[model samples]
Target: GIKGAFRTRIAYVVQTNGGQFPYELRVSDYDGYNQFVVHRSPQPLMSPAWSPDGSKLAYVTFESGRSALVIQTLANGAVRQVASFPRHNGAPAFSPDGS
Candidate 1:
């Protein structure tokens, strides 16, 4: 069996057919319990990546009419902008050390 599987958690994205925030980022335990929406946006959300320590999540968003990268702190639901390039930006992932 996988080590520490019982404590594993996961993050995912869900797109609604129509809603104020059509894109939703969600998280849940390995067994699907304790599920909740982590973030929501009117634009598309993709690449849900958890920090190595599991305290934060990083993802791509187009909320500004341009693709950008953002990091969200799970504890306080605080979001910080990481990058927003001229044309586009995407695919956010934390370094091995969660930097």
Candidate 2:
């Protein structure tokens, strides 16, 4: 027997200007509904990439005079710093194996 299921969902991250704090990361649907903020820091955030499993996201944040790579989970809103460098660390791309 063959069993299958169908699911329709879409998500995207948006960046907005930051006054005294850093930029904000917002997620919305394809039809531009259910808009909500995901992350916000004292530094600018950019390049939000979703994981292959759609369970996590990798992005960059500039707070310590440099940019740092951070991975955030969408389930419980847990974030972890993955990598950091002395210079800019923007544009995070996930691998094929989801690393």
Candidate 3:
């Protein structure tokens, strides 16, 4: 089994200057190898939180021209909008049991 902080994975964002997709949510090993994009959009993305089982990620995206919360399943690259409201939505996090 994987143990220790050094073996854990990390999620982060990258700004791609002058690209079709300007913002990217990516995952990588603790040492920064095997990096890959989990999601990308012309709009901004922020606050990536991993599920308890590490099967999904909850984040905020501005694709709708306003902040919205979404969840992405890692296995199939499926995304679903979880929350959308007036003004702003940000700082997504998963519950301890991922419910």
Candidate 4:
């Protein structure tokens, strides 16, 4: 037998430094509590997407004059560099198989 527990969670993307130039990724509770930064970059970071299970996040970062895709796990706070393009790589979406 399996019992499904109900929980409330909220996810958002925040831009650091007031979105001046270099932006960042942030997530928090539904009531705007427990706010935390998920990803940050001195150059710029944008377009954050959550995994199907909500256990990980995928985002793009521009730090080396190019954009790169990075996936971060919410459990242990581990990040994995997935892809990087020469010009720009933005907006990452996770597949059904968690890829």
Model 3, 59: alpha-carbon shift in Å? Answer: 0.4
Tens-digit per-residue lDDT, 6-88, candidate 4: 13455555555554455667777667778787766677677778787778888887766788898999888898889986777
In the predicted model 4, the residue pairs found to clash are none
Q: Estimate every model's Cα lDDT from 0 to 1.
A: 0.86, 0.71, 0.88, 0.72
- TM-score (all chains, Cα) for each model: 0.88, 0.76, 0.91, 0.75
The local lDDT score (0 to 100) that residue 29 gets in candidate 1 is 91
- Per-residue error for 13 in candidate 3, Å, reads 0.6
lDDT tens digits, residue span 17-65, model 2: 6566546776666565776778877766888887777777788877656
Best by lDDT: 3
Q: Model 4: number of clashes? A: 0
Residue lDDT tens for model 1, 28-93? 998889899999899899998888778899999899889989999999999999999898787787
Q: After superposition, how far is residue 40 of candidate 1 from its true place, in Å?
A: 1.1
Query: Which regions of candidate 1 are displaced past 4 Å?
Result: 1-7
- Kindly give the number of clashing pairs for every candidate: 0, 0, 0, 0
Q: 16-92 in candidate 3: lDDT tens per residue?
A: 88789999999999889989999989999999988878889889999999999999998899999999999989888
Weakest lDDT window of 10 consecutive positions for candidate 2: 1-10
Q: Sorted on lDDT, highest at the top, how do the candidates line up?
A: 3, 1, 4, 2
Candidate 3, residue 44: Cα displacement in angstroms equals 0.4
